[model samples]
Target: MSVTGTASDIASSESVPTSFGEFQPVGHVMVGLPTQGNVDALIDALHEAGWPPESLLRFTPGQSVEELQALVEGAGPLAGFGYEITLLRRYLELARNGYRWLLVKVDGTDEAAAAVQHARACHATLAVHYRRLVVEELL
Candidate 1:
């Protein structure tokens, strides 16, 4: 879950998020779009946010290819924005397998203010980024 490389690597991306310093991967992301319209919004938003394809992990309990693809498309708006967002799902093996908490594991260097700002932007109540954690909802 730790994608630690170099700063040069992040800066080199073509279309990068302005919140460059905030760029960091966390545990995982769980999204279930029950409708096509919702999927479109997510896709459009993700595209504008600059999400790296390799950074995402997906799962669908019982969804068709088309349905999954639509959700994937929308996920683009949420990636590489310097935030690692993971979802804990019910009825999933990982959840029952004892992976209850999605720990925000960091592997980089960044400022506190920057981290908090990134969390706010993502509307994340508990956020961990770039080796620094601004919120701890687990408490």
Candidate 2:
């Protein structure tokens, strides 16, 4: 089951070809989050691209992804806030034109799809559907 689409095309068009099975450091897929802020819509995009719901589970090459996962899953107080702050900081950095997309990665073959899905699954629970967005994955 492979996802084939323009979002996928962006990744595919890369002079370097990658697969949806494993991910390397800085190896990520970027998706255009909906301007409307709809996670389901993003999921639909992932579905269209053929990426698995839990596709962000595979891995490869380095401690970065793991560290990120630890930071995201921090059991300490204000863990969620920590991530929000980081994301917001990144957002600001990007606004300031100091953004590095590769720092935050989506290791799925269908990067666009994965990114959309990941963005959508930002703040929910297992019952809600956005819980899996923070987990690190490889492709």
TM-score for all predictions? Answer: 0.27, 0.26
The CA-based lDDT of model 1 is what? 0.30
| RMSD after CA superposition, every candidate | 14.6, 14.8
Q: Which ten residues in a row have the lowest lDDT in candidate 2?
A: 123-132
Choose the strongest candidate by lDDT.
Answer: 2
lDDT of 1 by residue, 1-139 (tens): 2222211111122222213433233332223333333333433344344434343222222323333233233444545242232321121333233221111222333333333343344333333333234423221
The models' CA-based lDDT, in order, is: 0.30, 0.33
- How well is each residue in 1-139 modelled by candidate 2, as lDDT tens digits? 4332212111221222222321122343422222223333444455555555544321111322333344334434454454443543333333233221222234444553445445546421111111234423221
Model 1 segments beyond 4 Å from truth? 1-26, 60-139
Q: lDDT score, residue 79, model 2?
A: 40
Q: Candidate 2 local accuracy as lDDT?
A: 0.33
TM-score result, candidate 2? 0.26
